[model samples]
Target: MPRSTHRAAPTPPGGLSRRTPDAAVPLRPLGRLHDVASALTALLASDLKEHGLTAPAFHILAVLRRAGPDHRLTTGRLAAIDMVTCSGMTVRADKLEKSGLVVRERDENDRRVVHLRLTERGLRLTDRVLAGLHAREARLTAGFDADELRALAGLADRLERALQHSAGAFRPVPPPH
Candidate 1:
């Protein structure tokens, strides 16, 4: 008779292995990514705080500034671009509006929808914020050669695309007023 080659699983204290061993292992790549993201977020948040804005608010202003000459973005579109909940985005926009950094206008073609535009002050502030951010980014990337910098940018872009693809199936809500 041939002997059985299968090995018995490790027994638990209670005489049963209720969960798989894989579940006990840490996800290293995810952990590392989270740590890096948190650090970057803190740095950006601190920089934006100096301008009396949060990272999300600064991003909103930047997006409006980069929009076409109309300088307007639909609330839904803004929320999508910012990758935030509609309600959360609405709150950010409200704060910006209160600070005289942005204004909400009713879309002419669609009365029910609102468009957001940066105020003159907002544009000026964004310009300053961008200059400062660019300086910081330059300092951080200074260690990298041109090719390495390009590669980093390309990788970042690809990562963003992958994230978007994964989350694209979820429907975005219209931003609240």
Candidate 2:
């Protein structure tokens, strides 16, 4: 098997390693974090595939399920919620519509406006997918209790905010309304 990309630097004889540059001190942890995130995402994607869904597609289904059957949202809203391009959301919506998992309707009052809602099939699928995901997440965090989980989430949020401020290229992401 291939070695992990996030190998830690060996401690030198005098506790000063010369293999890595001084600038990489912070980057080492970040790299490890990225590695773990990438691996976890891949695992989640694999799980989704078994359900005949992709991560992006599941995000839409989950969002719709959360919004309830009567509260239909537009493609733009879904795109914003998923942090994806409108075209990306449209493509996912198209696939879901074709699969009979979602229904898209034109506004009765305005022909230009389109709204989306989950079908009965979609509702059931979303429930199963979300439940499985939640269970998988819990298993992945098996060592952590509720308090630890909350603390980890708080720390992660802090890291996200720090990166958002440090990265000039990042646009301001507003709280979901």
> Model 1 compared with the native: what TM-score?
0.68
Task: Choose the strongest candidate by TM-score.
Answer: 2
Per-prediction TM-score: 0.68, 0.76
Per-residue lDDT of model 2, residues 72-141, tens digit only: 6787788888788988888899999998899998988988878788899988998888888889888889
Worst 10 residues of 2 by lDDT: 17-26
Question: Cα deviation of 137 in candidate 2 (Å)?
Answer: 1.3
Q: Mind giving the per-residue lDDT tens digits that candidate 1 earns over 82-132?
A: 777788789888899999999999988989898999889999999999999
Model 1: weakest 10-residue lDDT segment is 14-23
Candidate 2, residue 167: Cα displacement in angstroms equals 2.5
Runs in model 1 deviating more than 4 A are 1-33, 158-177
